[model samples]
Target chain A: MKKVYINSIGSISAQKTFENASFLETIADYNDTVLPAIDPVYKDYIPPAAARRMAKGIKMGVVASKIALAEANLENVDAVITGTGMGCVVDSEKFVSAIIDNNEEYLTPTSFIQSTHNTVGGQIALGLGCNGYNFTYVHASISFESALLDAKMQLETEEAENILVGGVDELGAHTVKIHRLINHIKPEAVTSKTVLNSKTSGAVFSEGANFFVLSNLRAAQTYAELLDVKMFNTLEIRTLSKAVLTFLQVNGLFISDVDLIILGNNGDVAYDTYYHELTDKVFAETPQATYKQLSGEFHTASSFGLWMASKIMKSQSVPEAAQLNTIQTSEVNTILLYNQYRGENHSLTLLRHVEV
Target chain B: MSELREELKEKIIEQLNLEDVAVADIADDDSLFGDGLGLDSIDALELIVMLDKDYGIKLSDPKEGRKIFESIGVMADYIAEHRTK
Candidate 1:
């Protein structure tokens, strides 16, 4: 019944995105198996006592949400929805190791309390003193898309005006070690300049927090209009284009209508072809961009993709850092973001420039 | 007794991640929580584990910890009297 606008945005990724002025002007390039986000000063946003107990993921979520709220010029919101794949892995690892190290004796509850997937949403609600609907989605790579869909439904139905939605994941030492053992992370470090060409079996893993303020009412802060969002748990490479076409058609669009297509190509030789196929044939003429080289690969890394798309729509400029193809459109309007993790959890998110 | 108080202060600083507050900043009689060092319920639980694991002094009730952890002076005295390890 109502149009949904991305009123405010916040991002804390491998690059310095927490500050709104810069949009991938300088990318934080890392050549590591597991990358961590360049952090903002936690003390300025959170009190010392509260921050001390917060794991990396929670702090990122809280700070990113605050930035979104501040940018929207709002004190509180109607709902807070968050998504995470690993869900506070730093604290989960601590709690599990503490249990084993102490022989299940004299264990404290702090890490255990913070280890849940919904803790970020709960903590944000507590911080804002907003006890409205709080939800968290943990659907692997499509986690962020799921949260966005939930918020979009409410906003479109006019059930809620302003909703805070975010996606966050923190890298854990033990988790990285296990993924490395399983070859989920690339064998060699891949730099941003050479990530897509690495021909690697695994990806360079990373973590980030990206948030958005969604409302039915558009204001000067509106970044873009959230046209549509869809997620698929399993997708074959051959059927990928068909799915994209159907999604676009349902949204009253066609392949030629898309101005830019943001892909999630993380240099994994086995699964990247799913995205490559789309670029090679179906959406070849569309200007393309990729972000995993800058954000690294995580379950919720697609939120970083959404953040980039929103920035492009609002600023009306596509940074050279995110360019995937040499083809640039004269007038960029509609952006199609497609992401999948390890050949599963495929997500399609469409964002368009808010028509003035 | 003064040595024990200083040791308690250092332990509190390290355990609670009080990076801005140093040992010398906390006086012996200063309260450990609520308008003093500003510790909360979570910090109290951390101190309880410290008592059991570090000093072999276990208090089954967390309410008892309120009295024992009132100040650095009180905490040091309790540990000195009850420590078994």
Candidate 2:
């Protein structure tokens, strides 16, 4: 089997991730229950003509993918795989609202066309004129993990040399209102310093697009070698520990072998117990880090977790802001990323240091 | 005729998110698609909806929009003649 490496990464998140020169150095202070990503100037990466029709999700996806491809120094890739849980939800809301308000008489196809979950992948393919394999996964929180897994399989089997894979989601006002009504979002704003300690029942909703180029051929831009990625639609809280153990054991890793563990603790008092079980028990001694507080909570927030892992490996330094524990490592190498959404769609992604 | 043409330009700019373009930027006879204003098929769909919603002129077949939406002047003329609202 061929080794797959994260050759390049481009992220537009709640923080200033798109610049590549900084990684959560100066954080964006958000005290709102619903946070929005710090958007990049779309015109820099996308032409105005093409960007005019793109909604937030598409714009973010296109720009992030372009950044990834550019960093990898490639104009095109063999495949484009995207995972979006809510799809172009902003467009979806627009289309649905238009249909209702206009009584289905005057309805534009732009929003409807852009509303599809695969629109990002499709648009990327269109922008690059890549007619090769293109697929989009829409599995709730594991959506991004699904895309990464597919890319990994193809790279491992040598089915494709390089692949552009991404997880993108845009905020929808209607969706946020509904999730808020159901208490899926925090009732009040919680600062990053207080998000974990907020003891809230729901997370701070947010959106982002994180894209990476995965190739069997490692490059200087390679962040780390993606060892394995696994997703579970449903895993009992009790068996979660064993699942992580088995995942690491299969990869020839142990609890101590992991230099760092990046977690997806979104500050939901209810579901966070799942992570607390691992961090408070099994991996208690390991250096733990949290990111959902920084990126805010979205379906594919795990991709943000992966992004954090990749950055830490590349720089060999974990941002002081993201660490959940003060126990720092001398040399950062192996990383285990664990993320779950509202006690479901659990994903474990293992990445290791690649000696270039 | 000129008033409607100007109004159409303003509306088109607003509806299509042509933030960089203004009402005066689009001449009366400028092509709205493919090289002039550089609109695409999707923009045509949006304009079709705008016609039905704002002017009550429904063009069920989007392909038929090619003639009416050839330019701001053409669209204004068509809407001026057929507008029910």
Candidate 3:
């Protein structure tokens, strides 16, 4: 089996972390219930002719992937895989609303064409003229992790050497309104300092795109070695502890071996307890960190968390803003990322510092 | 003819969600795609529906739309010639 390494990563989130030089230097500090990504000047990466038809999610994904490829020093990849929970939702909402408001008349096809879940992956392929394998996953929160697992499997089996994999979600006004109605978004704005203690049932919703180039060969610019990735469709709260231990055991590691543990605590009182369970029980002694408060909560927000983890392992520095516990490690090496959404679709990713 | 062209520009902006661009920015003779207004395949579809809904010109194939939607002037002329409504 071939070893998989994250060669490069690009992310556009609520925080200013898209550029390689910056690492959450200045946070957005949103007090609103719904937060949107700090968009990059996409024209710098995508030509207006090609970008005119792209939905916000597709544009972000494509631009981020371009940035990742540029950083990896590669023009094309063997495969492109993407994950999006509410895929091309701005277009979807537009199409659906037009159908309703116009009584099915004067309904344009652009919105409908861009509304597909696989549009981002297809667009990436079109942009690169890459006819290799392309896939998109839309299984809610685990969507991005599933894409990563697929890419890892392909790399391990030697099916493809370099793959572009990413996760993206764009906030739509209508979707936000409905989610707010259902109490999925916070009722009021909460500052980053107070998000964890909001004690609310929902999270501060946000959206972003995180793209990475994974290759079987380690290079000088490689971020980290992707040791293992696992996802669970359903994990009972009681069995979660045992599950984590078994996962680590299979990976030939223990609780103490993990230098830093990244947790996805979105400040939802209902789901934050899951993080507490592991933080208080299994990983109490490990240096802990979380990023949702910085990036806000989205279906694919865990991708941002993984991006942060890769940065920490590569730079050996955990931003003070992401610290969840004071147990500091002398040197950052092995890091484990755990994330879930609404008490379901849990994922565990292990990455190790690769010395070039 | 000028009114029809202006109306077409409005429909295109509203349909394509060109929220950043205004109707006045679209010159009648300027290209609707590529360098002029920066439309693409998705915008072609939106214009196709406009042709069908507002002008009663049903073009089943998108390939046929390329020649018809070259510019706002071309679009208005095509609708004026074939519009059943």
Q: Residue by residue across A145-176, what tens digits does model 3's lDDT show?
A: 99999999999999999999999999999999
What is the lDDT for A47 in model 3?
A: 78
Q: Rank the candidates by DockQ, best first.
A: 2, 1, 3
lDDT of 3 at A148: 96
Predicted candidate 3: what Cα RMSD to the true structure? 2.6
Candidate 3 lDDT at A277 equals 95
TM-score (chain A only) for the predictions, listed in order: 0.99, 0.99, 0.99
Worst 10 residues of 1 chain A by lDDT: A25-34
lDDT digits (tens) for residues A13-57 of candidate 2: 999999877778898878889888888989988888888788989
**Model 1 Cα lDDT, one tens digit per residue, A184-294:** 999997788898899879999989999999999999878999999999999898899999999999999998899999999999999999988999999888999999999
- Give the per-residue Cα lDDT of candidate 3 at A171: 94
**Residue A121 alpha-carbon offset, candidate 3, angstroms:** 0.7
Number of the top candidate by TM-score? 1
Top model by DockQ, which number?
A: 2
Q: In model 1, what are the clashing residue pairs, if there are any?
A: none
